[model samples]
Target: MTAGNNGTNPPEGDDPFGYLYRSENGAPSAQGQQANSPRRSYNEVRAVGDRRYGQQQRPQPDQSPSPYYAAPETQPGGGQGGSGGPGRRAAGRANQEPARRNGLLIGALAVVGAVILGVGAAFAFSDSDDDKAGADPGASESADAGQDDAPDPDDGPPEEDEERPLPQENGSSLRLENGPVVAGDVEGSRAKDGSYIHGFKEGSAALWQPEIEEDGEYTVFVGYTVPGKDMSLQVSANDASPYSARFSNYAGAEEGDWAKGWTQTFAWVELKKGTNDIRIACGDKAEQCSVAMDRIWLEKGHVKK
Candidate 1:
């Protein structure tokens, strides 16, 4: 048989390395040929051994996946096309610089994008706040006005009503000469209804009986006519010393006009309660009253005139 058909030959003894070229039955190879088969090459056997060893080896979890180059002196070179020399270290440094630069660039881009997004968010928030405030501007002002109009809790109590002045009280009134005759030269006038008392000669006197209830200050007023020179009168209460005084009027024109009436307020006087005696008489002066007295009464807050 030809050398190409040698698979049909018998086995050679004492050939330990000959098993790859010829099996026991001399079967054809997977390429469908029984032609000349040599032992596997050194490179092929080594490649196969490396694959099997790699499968059995454990992976290091801390190994950096992308550090593509490293110096053999520090760490074995892991980059592409690395020669088994110090040139591997130079190539490793060159490739590492570019990788670091790329990493920084990516980080810078991420920061810039974050800044841009933050600025946009800030602007959006500010615009939303402005819109809300502008939606009802006058509402805030009205609320302020309402607060101003509200009454203050600190204000004091309401003012009390003012007290009014007391009303004036009056005592009884009587014709002057109609007072009980008390040792005087006073005479009844011919005037109508005992309207007057006349002839108050010097030292002449008459009295008034007042129905008083308490001992207090009172006012005495007299209505009279003086047509001659000013006439003076002595007024007394209970015949007391300091309780007596003289009152005079200058309302005279002449003796012929003695009938014209006038009124004079005699000063405040004090009276003992109940049925007090009040006297009026011509003055100590010899030429004292020819004056006529008409009405007499008592009131408060008056003075002799």
Candidate 2:
């Protein structure tokens, strides 16, 4: 028999014992022996199988266009959307942000500097105030010195006593009698002539031994009384010149009868200390008037500067 006869093809009835071959239809069958067949890798087999079975491979995430991706809409400029638009605007704002931040920082620094300056100025002013608040020792010392040198109001020298008229022997010193009449047992009578008129009907008239060596302001006080009339007292020095105003007397009215005494005072009378005639009178009517004279006191002193 030849290589392939019925018997040699023999057991074609049962499937090959060791290995089985499947057709493209996945049916197990024994067929003609393949010779010099092209070998396929696993990936190539998968590709061919996918092509033959009309199956599609899913696209890789990285390889496919994303569903979220949007086509860029843009202006004519190639900047952002398609090329240049909003991207350029955002880039410009980003560039300017640093400048703005720098400006803010600089402004903050300026404010801090101003605050420091203000604090320094306040400290300087406070120092000046503190200086002013302290008392000046030099000024206090000067005031103390001045006070030490100043005169004491209460402990000063006593005022000098005024010189008084001297009492003399003889009636040459005329005594004031009733009214303007000068009457003394030793001295001759002298007339007042109403030279010094006061409001009284009675006054005093006297003559003093003048001492020209003692030239000073003299004050003479004559006290007297009159009856029934409002009276004032007056005195005159030297000759009785009607125009000579070296006379002074009490200012207001007098009280009491001639028997009762009324007293008055005369102010300053410029006089020489030599023999000078002094007359006292009443300011009543000359026709019928009289005054009772009392004591005559004289004082000599310097004029106030």
Candidate 3:
């Protein structure tokens, strides 16, 4: 057998362990330097590290990109780069001037538009006033003439009422008996000038009775607002006795003053001289009105209408 057939020892000048670990570029290391040529050993090829290697290390190329491998930096203003100085700020202001002027111009236009609108409105108002003044000379006079009367403004705007003569004082008087059915409104009505009783709800009224010493024929005047076209009062004297007497409104009373009227609405009835009750019911009509009497005059003789 030949020596090549047995693999007991390595080839001439070769190391079986050193074949695994070698240095790159065959550079001299820091350890095991020669005396004459200053030779270095493989242990000092690189810096020592904290390593735990079960297998032998093999040589490999460096893969990191540290500063040692980077290219040198070039100065600016040589290629695509420019000198970034105060000129950049000047260019920015030059680009913004048009926008600033546009803003100022828009503000001035708005102020001018507002002034024009105010002047137009004032002129329009003045023209309309002039036209109205020239149109009707007696417009105010006509409005006053349309009224039922032109009473002194001091007398508190003549009451809203039908045209009627003013009130006159009554001649004779009687012991006025305030009725029991008098509610608070009736007292309030009594408080009103020329208004005695007030019946605010339907089917309600103020009652009254007079003691007559000697009764033959009497004149009665009722004061109240204008009666409805067909509004009739349901009244009775002494136990609901049928007394269908047509009572006329005390003229201006219907005109709305305390509704006091001096007109006569009388009836001829013979009495035995006792409690002659008078119930003037305004309830059959609207709560507003039917009949009210501020004063009553029962004279000696039968008075005509």
Per-residue lDDT of model 3, residues 168-209, tens digit only: 221112222233122222322322353343333455544445
User: Model 2 misses residue 239 by how many Å?
Assistant: 4.2
Query: What are the clashing pairs of model 3?
Result: 34-39, 253-259
Per-candidate count of clashing residue pairs (backbone under 3 Å):
2, 20, 2
- Candidate 2, 1-305: lDDT as tens digits: 23435463322222222123556675544442321223334344453223321134545556744345424442244355433557777877899999999999999999999999999999999888768755464766787899998778887875458744353222223554553433332111221331222222433334444454476676665444445454333456775442121222232333433333344445456777567766655433442334444445565553321
Q: Write the per-residue lDDT of candidate 1 for residues 1-305, one digit (tens) a residue.
A: 33334664533322222345554587643332323444334345453324421124533567643344434334444343446555776777888999999999999999999999999999999888878777576877888899997767788655448632322211123323433231222233332344555666665676677676456777776666566456667777676643333334455445556544344536467776677777777655646665566566666444444
Query: Against the correct fold, how does model 1 do in TM-score?
Result: 0.35
Off by over 4 Å in 1: 1-194, 242-252, 301-305
Given candidate 1, what's the lDDT at residue 199? 66
Question: lDDT for every model?
Answer: 0.55, 0.47, 0.46
Give per-model TM-scores.
0.35, 0.28, 0.30
- Sorted by TM-score (best first), the order is 1, 3, 2
Question: Once model 1 is optimally superposed onto the true structure by TM-score, how far is the C-alpha of residue 85 displaced, in angstroms?
Answer: 99
In terms of lDDT, which candidate is stronger, 2 or 3? 2
Best by TM-score: 1
Which residue runs does candidate 3 get wrong by more than 4 Å?
Answer: 1-195, 227-231, 247-264, 283-289, 300-302
Which whole-number lDDT from 0 to 100 does residue 202 have in model 2? 33
Q: Candidate 2: which stretches are off by over 4 Å?
A: 1-206, 210-213, 232-234, 239-256, 281-284, 287-289, 302-305
Candidate 3, position 161, lDDT: 59
Q: Indicate the TM-score of model 3.
A: 0.30
